[model samples]
Target: MHKQFSDVDTVRAELLQNLVDDGETVTNLGSITRLEVVSRIEEVTKKIISSLSMEEAPVLTLKSRSRWSNVRFSKLVGLLLTMGGTVSTLRSDCPSTVMKFALILKALSAIYKLVQSDSYVTKRDIYYNDPQLFGSQKTLDTIVDDISCLLKVPRRSLHVCASTKGLISGDLCYLEEDGTRVDCTSTVVPVSSSVSGIINIVSSAKFVLVIEKDATFQRLVDDEFCINFYPCIIITGKGVPDVNSRLMVKKLWETLHIPVFALMDADPHGIEIMCIYKYGSISMAFEAPTLTVSSMLWLGLLPSDIESLGLPQDALIPLTVADERKLNNIKKRPYMSFHPAWEKEMELMLRWKQKAEIESLVSIAPHFLTRVYLHNKLSYGGWI
Candidate 1:
């Protein structure tokens, strides 16, 4: 008989020892087979290697040659795709990461040598362009897999925590949220500031003027006038203001019984911004249930002021079918349900497609603004 140490017992001992070393508690030492023991050891070793490699992951720094070539290839592909899908032909013109294997195969062929025999080149030339062979594909695959997994999940799920304050983390600082690492510390600070500012103002003011543009807000401050002639706060910056700003403004108005007057440009984007502010449907900004400020009002860009301001004929951007239908439906509702001024303004915008900017009226004659507009709009006691 061949000398056979008990295979099953030996394997079970080995697997139990490996599991114990890997911080796993083996409940039954006798339960494992030799094959299972070997497999478990391999798996544990692979996990250790993966963790070490991740900790030692090399930073990808773009050199001048790499940057230029990458940009050139990207531009070529972008242009080709833009011009009716000519990317197949353009792929032949450059070696891009997207087609690295194909390019390497082509470069190795006799055809490639025949095309460039006289040219003097160094191994560095090929190495710089094809660094992946020298680098690690495993690392790249891990990163890509992580990104793919992240993209499949809902953005709100990425937040560290959700509270009445705002999204704690996992918000896309620039675009829509992905699993891309963001400094939660940096994002939360500004949100806190915005919340604090809103709380401060809402506690004091009888009404808040949420001005979309800084320039228009400056003009209002200079002239000492706003829609409701009440103390106001301006949301200055690009796109829609952040979630914290909207929440702060909304809570202040709702809790303090202070009304919010949204004054924005008369363009489609501007109107959409006001609607988002009033009704809270901007999913990208915040995930909370829709919060409509019952006291909120739209109070600028009246139809009667358009012709007098000499605005461009093209200033009248067309309303969408949805907007037209909304305005029409609002008109049929009882007067007590909606503000008469708001209903009238929406109807005028739907019919004429005309919009007037607050800037246009700002440049009007001082006499007209002070005597005719301001005096009529604001009472002697300075109430709107």
Candidate 2:
């Protein structure tokens, strides 16, 4: 067995001292309790009722969360809601707004019951209650986020959770809300049930690796990568991470105070996904303080590595039209101005006219990623 990196604690701790996450301040991560959610629900309900009593069309002024115009970048907190940000109005009397306005109230009614009952439901389950009204799961997703932003509460606080889309493994143990003990040291598992309800997190891991793709994560599992590293936690959001995974990553960084590194493809989408984990997304900027881990370290296969490692010409994928467009947009992001290393790596990929996946490391050897490349990078300080 490849137990070359058998020592997890000492080496991991050493890395902790050497590796740093520049903008990781999760101490101020915000959470509201079930009682608070109920309180806010009651307050909002009363205002609507008061408007109805006065025969006035009830109007809701919500923070515009799904737009770039509403966000501001902060070196301290990453992307966040701008001060006195852009607002959108939803009026019950307006023909264009009435359907959505009704939908929001119905969803709120379900949420109120869930909080009071001390239970939670997935966004899918909520959507199913009246699918025709919601029109699509995407619409319900929007409504849930809109309500969260309007109330300035974590979406989980609304007694709603997204369908978990991430996976985890490696040296860590914790209790779920139902008192289910989860141990990730030996096997891969879903992130956790009701992540907000998890408690007593305990880990001896040296660092956390946020993987970009599930296929690569599964490859690591088959190679027993974590077993070799002993106490290193590895996770994947599958692709663009959902809220539960983001919260778990933020929580782990705050609690463990370990170095968090992102292992991703040398593609533009992969880079954007890592940025979402580190800098927060423009669509959900209002929740950046709790949802982002700005101190994220870049692990490989970086764009520069594709050339340096000499991956096969065929393995190097040509950038698609969409890829080029996304890369251009990524270069224009606010953080790009500060990260010249990122700029240099991107330029290399553009000049090469190719992108590479973590899977391409297989060309070097079947176990090159686990036995050679990763072992070397992780054992030593080989990350950006």
Candidate 3:
């Protein structure tokens, strides 16, 4: 009462030949329901799997009615081998060939399971290599390290739940061994004066003043000059701003709409430091555009000030060849392209190969700064 059907290979060959004869490129074949066809294919695959010494079993190919069909069958067999533990054994026995294939298939399966399952792996568990080499271990480890360091959490127990029914995004909390929840982010502790001092200044200041050297700030404070200035905050030492400091400064300037003024020495290094503060230092991981002062407002020792102060000619700092090239290259910048005043300053510096410090000028009489000499002649000309 039943009609005989061809085996998988015969059916596949027939289908392919039919495609070639009709000049139709077979994109796919309809769902295969024939029991005889499936049985024959399964038998062939089982024989292939059994024939290869466990070491070679993973690379076996299957005959199918279409390319898609072959791919699906191969994946299915790989899944089976992975689940059956034969894949791991084969990998362990022969590492170079079978091991790599098994590891790849297992990784894919793990990822698929991760996506499909309701339970999610934490950012910590996924990173830790306790299980074995899996999906992007190095990348995962680096991410975990960064988050742990930034949030100041112990790496061993840090875990973040996926946004489900109740959890908020980016909320890192602590979890116990038995999965009890503790709100680490909620506990408010006393804020340090250094942090609070900066915050208070940000809150009150119309424009924040950032000074590089501690001694300069000390001199300003000691002289009791403009101590009533609410918004002026000084950064001590020569180091670039850290992440927390950069973020705080950016938030004050950008979010609060406050202007920022930076004071530093007049040398190449000082200029570079100010630029880095505004544009972000390459060494530090932090970046914020709002934290920089305008280069046009750069003040300190002008070339004329150096000559007028009667400071030793030897006090002028020398410019390297690289510095000369950098000065010349500034002409090409969109913001600073071709200023005669800037060119003249560069020419003077190159001629003498000397650099001047802001402290030198700051150490001079205030009358000199306020009256007889301005930081830059260009400022007086209204070119800035």
RMSD of each: 22.7, 6.0, 22.1
Query: Distance (Å) between predicted and true CA of 28, model 1?
Result: 46
lDDT by residue for model 3 (1-384), tens: 111121334434654554456453333232122342234334534654665655454442212111221111111001000011111122323556454444434433333344344234654455463445645655454443333222222222122221111111111233333444533122311112122123222133334445555556555554433333232333333334333344334434443444445566555556555544554432221111222223223344555456667766554567788877766654443333334565565577767777776666544664343233332332243221
- Residue 293 of model 3, lDDT score: 25
Error of 3 at 264 (Å): 2.0
Off by over 4 Å in 3: 1-206, 228-231, 237-239, 255-258, 281-286, 289-296, 307-314, 320-335, 338-344, 362-384
Question: What is candidate 2's TM-score against the reference?
Answer: 0.89
The Cα RMSD in angstroms, rounded to one decimal, for candidate 2 relative to the true structure is 6.0
Question: TM per model?
Answer: 0.40, 0.89, 0.40
Q: List the residue pairs that clash in candidate 2.
A: none
What is the lDDT ranking, best to worst?
Answer: 2, 1, 3
CA lDDT of each prediction against the hidden true structure: 0.39, 0.82, 0.38
Question: Whole-model lDDT, candidate 3?
Answer: 0.38
Candidate 3, poorest ten consecutive residues by summed lDDT: 75-84
lDDT for 125 (candidate 2): 96
Write the number of the candidate with greater lDDT, choosing between 1 and 3: 1
Best by lDDT: 2
> How many pairs of residues collide in model 2?
0
